[model samples]
Target: MTLKQDTTSITTSISNPTLLAKVDQLRDLNIGQHVPLPQLVVVGDQSSGKSSLLESLSGVPFPKDQNLCTRHATQITSRRDKDECVHVRIIPGPRASEDHKKQVEAFQTKVSSASEFRDKFVDILKKANEKMGLRTDLSSGHGGAIFSEDVLKIEVHGPREDYLTIIDVPGIFRTTVHGTTKDDMVMVKNLVKRYIRDDRTIILAVLPSNVDIATQEILELAEEYDKNGKRTLGVLTKPDLVMEPTMRASVCDLVMGQKRPLTLGYFLVQNRSSDDGVKTVSELDQGLRIQPWSDLPKDRVGILALKEQLQSLLLDITRREFPKLVQDVASQIRQCTVELNKLGPSRQDEREQRSFLSRMAGIFQDRARAGLAADYNAHSSFNQTDLRLITHVVNLTDVFNADFQRLAHSRHFSSLEESQPLESPEPSDAGDRSESQSGLSVDTLRVLLEESGVDKISPKEQMELAEILVLPKDIPMPNEGFTDWIKEVYLQFRGLELGTFNPNLLSVAFTEQSRKWGDMTRIYMSRIIVTVHRFIAATLRSICPEEPTRIQLWAEILEGLLDCYRKAMAQADMLIQVQQRKQPYTLNRQFAADLSKSRGHRITALLRPKAKEDRRFAEPQYMVNLDDIAEAAEGKHNTELLQEEIHDILHAYYNLALDRYIDNIFQLAVDHSLLHGPDSPLKVFTQDWVLNLEARQLEDIAGETISEKKRRSRLSKKITDLHNALKILKSRDSY
Candidate 1:
């Protein structure tokens, strides 16, 4: 089945305006420097009429020779204009910028005459090869040579030109030639791959009809980059070379998508060979009208059809990609702006330096205040909850208090009555007799006897007989063994006595338990300090305009602030340690209340009746002596009450201390060290102090290097181009 021809429609399609003009505007702004742009990348094997096809489409006679035609990528951009002119230039690869600059100075020019354009074009390419260090000497014995990935750009403007831009890359080769090495073959293939790999690119895979499509490396490479073949268009160049009927039929099958179909399909074009001389568009058109061509579909052959198809494809792609391209440019602009801000300003003198430092100081001060106030919104770096240093301190305080309270109630500090046996069944009669005989003066024995009777006597009775009866031995007399034993038992019950306060065993337990507070708080404080340090560094870099001054001042400020932070943290830790030492202060009224409550609960639990299952009789009654049980329960209840009081006091004090420690951290570590002006390390940035720095030091600190200047220039250019590209896109009604 032969495809029908539409010669008039094809001609009209070629003349229609395309979105290539918009694409050219994007290229002109060099948006590709930051992001890939929509393009048509032409790729094929060596001597596949790639140059001829490009020359025909562009109407520019590109140099054709084994070594001169295509070494690096040559971008040919043509547009319709009233004036007829040609402009040529080179966009150097990253590593070859200097050579490119030199070449531009020597070879960049404009031409109006076709002959002059051709002659000057070849000269520029040869010079570009030299500048790019691409060796032209094939005769050199050493066949290995490197090729450059640089591009030579040519632009043409004329009334007859279509608004289009296409990239013609070095043709792929199987083996090394004079100036080209096996590496060069790889380099060219890689270059082609880079272009085709871009989703926005429309790949034109050129191949001569004489060569087997299987042997064409570019077709395989294109397939590799565009596996679905959605954007790949096969251009079977040198269609005139297929003389045999069988071969023609095969070519027809390829074009008609019968063999190895591409999504975009194929077009057969009769491109002018080297011996065909410089043929005009009219002559090429006239030639295609001949015998075999007349029998073929008009839309499937000739440059007009190829141009129309390319324009249509490029426009479709551009429309699809334009919005994204705008968004990308805007994103890049923001990124570059951020980077430039980080690099800081190029301060020319002391005044600017002082102003810059002052501004940075102000920003730092504001952020520090925000941190202290726990205002997360004021600074993006601070998290809403934990990252705010004050909030973190508060959280830590809660944890510390909870831990302290837990320790106070732990079994380690439980009352001796609950934790140990009540007594050793009062000493044996033999032991008691031995003690009584061993050593007690009459008076001491009498006093002990009186103390033993005290519980039997009422408090009123003891007060009434105070003068007649000798006072019980509050102080033990010498040679009194019984009195000594009484004192020892009293001391054991008291745990350890410090002054008037009998510091509960809970204190000792807590000291050991909370020892990690110092180290933990230290680690926590260190993180806060580091966070503030990084913030200061980043803030200084962004706000300060002078690079040299920013570096020097940042170092000095960081050192001083960290030193102040260290001192403040030490002070806060000292408070924590002091609180730790005085732990378990159980002097609060709440302690008494809690202790009473606990005692009541314990007594109630003891008095409560047992379950019916535990009893053998249907009616359960007092099997044991109620009086003896009540007396024992009373003693145990008193012991538990005392222990509970002590633990309650300790917990109350721990809570108070934790609260005080948190306040101290905020007051000392955060407020004084970071937020306070005169005492803060950040005070060094005061306008007077910065302005008073020696001129020589300022110069040394703020000096800009050549590389820095170059970087700034490049960034500035990129930002401007991005902004321009964005403007262009925004102005378009379709966008």
Candidate 2:
């Protein structure tokens, strides 16, 4: 056959070049670097005739030898144009440094004829391999970098070419032989898998008919990714070598889909080896027309039929994926644009740096204001707990108040009798304390007589009570039992010729009752400090685009935020000091009411006449009758009444002081000084603060660093290229 007829026999006809060219354009823009694009990828075992297949399909003679193997991924793209031309270039990997990328991209060549391409291809491959840090010799060890992920891109344009693009990756191999190490074997396998694993890629599984298909690693990987064989097309190569009937029938069964069935089925093709003289397509077709191959389907044979199938399949895939490709490109464009915006414009000089700082400060203030006001609708960040300033403040204050009510007292009184030790308190007996309400009531003062079932007392109190209870009964139990410990104090401090004890006793008892105020409030203040720090960080991250910038700004203002927090803590400490003043005093009406009610309860319980022995055994009872209270008031137990009076007064004053102190801490220290007022930590990054900064300080906080500028430039270029890609997809005209 003549050369024209031979070329025409292998040429793939294209009905819709526009769709394929759009795909080729997207691949040219390197859109696949950011996202996976639809295309055909050739994968197989080492020396499996993958290069021979590419040569047949592209009509370009590739350098071939028995020991030669594909060293890196090669992307071959062919498009229809007026003149026949070839262009080769290197597309750097993602991890390549900027300088290395420039050096790699600088390697480019152009050829005007097929003969020139064939003559120069081997030398070009050798150069590309050496540039990738590998020796050209397949069995020689010369470099540390054994394998690469970079791609060698070749663009072919000619009047007779079909619009097609195929990515050929390094073949999978089992043994680490020759120049290959174990890591190199694994790397090649991983590289092939990465390309074929993309759903948009159509896998061309090349299998040699001379070898068992099951043993080939490429088919296993193809099945692994394309489980149903939906996107995979099987290509049987070296069919001329299967001479035996049994072996030929096995290959034919695969070709006819009788064994290991695939959705796209299989095709058989004969590739010319290096030892074979210049052979025509007619000779290749005649070889496939023999007995076992002729019995197989006609559509699944020869190089021309395989080319036609590949082109049609690729067109279908490109058409189906075009809209999605456009959408992905647009989405990535928006993302890159947003990243560029976050980096903001160049901030080289102090004025520009100050301007950038001012803008950041404005954003910080807006977010901080919204967070402090609980206006969650203002910013999405306010919904986060660490950034919800007001909500955390309220929750923390409520928790602090509850902790004081439950834990502030050194000892607690229990109403349960010794026999009913584990029973829960009656609902009516539970106290309802709040920030504005007193926590103590008559139920809180029900001191246990036997002391066995008393709740909330420490181990120390229990030990002391045990010692007191063990005292001899003949030793005047009135001043000996646990109940009269306070009476002993009153007696010791009594003034001359008076029924009342000295007022100093009240101050001393009250001071001891609220003694934990300092440590507890300090802990509470520390918690608030943490909340402030978190809020500031969350707000800054939401406002700043880069991590380094956020870190620098944090360093600039971290000390100030802490200083404001410390000042607020000092103010809170002042409130605690007020609770420890020389005299216990309060004007709250509730204190007097609580005191009177407790006194009446104590007096009535002490003076009631004893019940009958059987009735007392049936149920525990307390004296609550008005007549009993009046009778108790008329009795003469001066020391007992005086002790009970002192206890009641101390409890009432404690409850009143606790309520007011919690309010003071929240309003004066937390709200006024730390969060919202003039000393607010959020105000540390204001516009005025930026204006006051020195030139060096401004640059340190806001100036863009070398890496940041490089990142910005990269993103800008990516966005511009993606936009251009989108336009290419939208264009309706043919090239």
Best by lDDT: 2
Give me candidate 1's TM-score against the actual structure. 0.58
Evaluate residue 190 in candidate 2 and report its C-alpha lDDT on the 0 to 100 scale.
Answer: 83
Q: Candidate 1 deviates by what RMSD?
A: 18.1
The lDDT values for all models are: 0.63, 0.74
TM-score of each: 0.58, 0.64
* Counted clashes in each candidate structure: 5, 0
Residues 1-735, candidate 2, lDDT per residue (tens digit)? 111216563454787788887777777667777878888999988789898888777755656542336777888988878898889888877567778677778888899965577677778877876776665565667654666777888888887677778889988888887767898888888888889888889999999999988898887899899998999999999988888889999998999889999888899998877777777656676788888788887789988788788888898888888888888988999899888887787787888899889988998898888888888899776766667777666655665665666666544432223333312232321223333133333233222111222123346433423321112121111111323556667777788736677899877766666677777777667556656766787788888867887888888987787678778878988888877766988778999898887665654345545322344555855535566555655665887667766777776787788788888988897889878889988899899999999998877888889888788778987998888888998998886
Candidate 2, superposed: residue stretches over 4 Å from native:
1-5, 9-12, 66-68, 144-146, 332-357, 364-558, 561-682, 692-721
Candidate 1, overall lDDT? 0.63
Model 2 reaches what TM-score against the true structure?
0.64
Q: Give per-residue CA lDDT, model 1, range 1-735, as digits (tens).
A: 111111233344333344566567677555665777889999998889898888777766667655676778888987667887888766665444655556644656688854567657667677767766666765565532346666777888766566678898888888776656677777778788887898899999998987888888888888888999999999988877778878877787887789999999888887666676556655676676765556667777788888888877877788889788878889999999988876676555676655555556677667656765778887666642323545443443343333333322212222224333322222222222332222443334434423433224346434432332232222211121322332343356574443333444555645644565565555445444443444455455545656666667765555455566667676766766775676465455765665565455445445444312337667754343466446545545444445444454553455555556656765776556655635565454555655676776565556456777678778887899888877776774431
Please give the RMSD to the true structure for each candidate, in Å.
18.1, 11.6
